[model samples]
Target: MSCPICGAEQQTKYRPFCSKRCSDLDLAKWLNGSYAIPAEAAAEEEEWNEADRSSTEPRH
Candidate 1:
């Protein structure tokens, strides 16, 4: 298999990445939001509104 980050041959320790550097780079990309799963804004907005309402409500 090849590295997803650099297209180099994948190493045993890093099956999807060639080395620690590539692995770290991929992690950084994820942490910085370079990659994302698409979401529908309408659904997300509804969820957010529900969460906000619940948070503001008095608890028993």
Candidate 2:
């Protein structure tokens, strides 16, 4: 299999990563919030955006 970080061949120990460096890089990304699961905003936030948008839109 190939490493997700650098696209190199994966090592047995690292499995999906090529080396400790690549594996650590992945972990760092997670720790620093670079890798994240997408989610929708909360109801209140959505409502706020709706009100904001309405105020900015030009009248028909």
Candidate 3:
């Protein structure tokens, strides 16, 4: 398999990535939201319901 970030042949040490740099690059992309999927408007309603449910639950 090749590195998704640089197309280098994947090394056993890096598994899906070819090197530590590529792995870090991939992580940076996620941290910077470069890999984020666009949220649908309906997701907000679901998030609000989840928050309400959590707030109503008693903490142990």
lDDT of 1: 0.94
lDDT of 2 by residue, 1-60 (tens): 899999999999998899999999999999999987877667879999999999999998
- Once model 3 is optimally superposed onto the true structure by TM-score, how far is the C-alpha of residue 30 displaced, in angstroms? 0.7
- Which pairs of residues have clashing backbones in candidate 2? none
**Judged by lDDT against the true structure, how good is candidate 2?**
0.94
lDDT of each: 0.94, 0.94, 0.93
- TM-scores for every candidate against the unseen true structure: 0.67, 0.67, 0.63
Ten-residue segment with the worst summed lDDT in candidate 1? 35-44
In candidate 3, how many clashes are counted?
A: 0
Candidate 3 Cα outliers beyond 4 Å, as residue runs:
42-60
Ranking by TM-score: 2, 1, 3
Clashes of each: 0, 0, 0
Tens-digit lDDT track for model 3 on 1-60?
Answer: 889999999999998999999999999999998896776868998999999999999999
Clashes of 1: 0
For lDDT, candidate 1 versus 2, the one ahead is: 1
lDDT of 3: 0.93
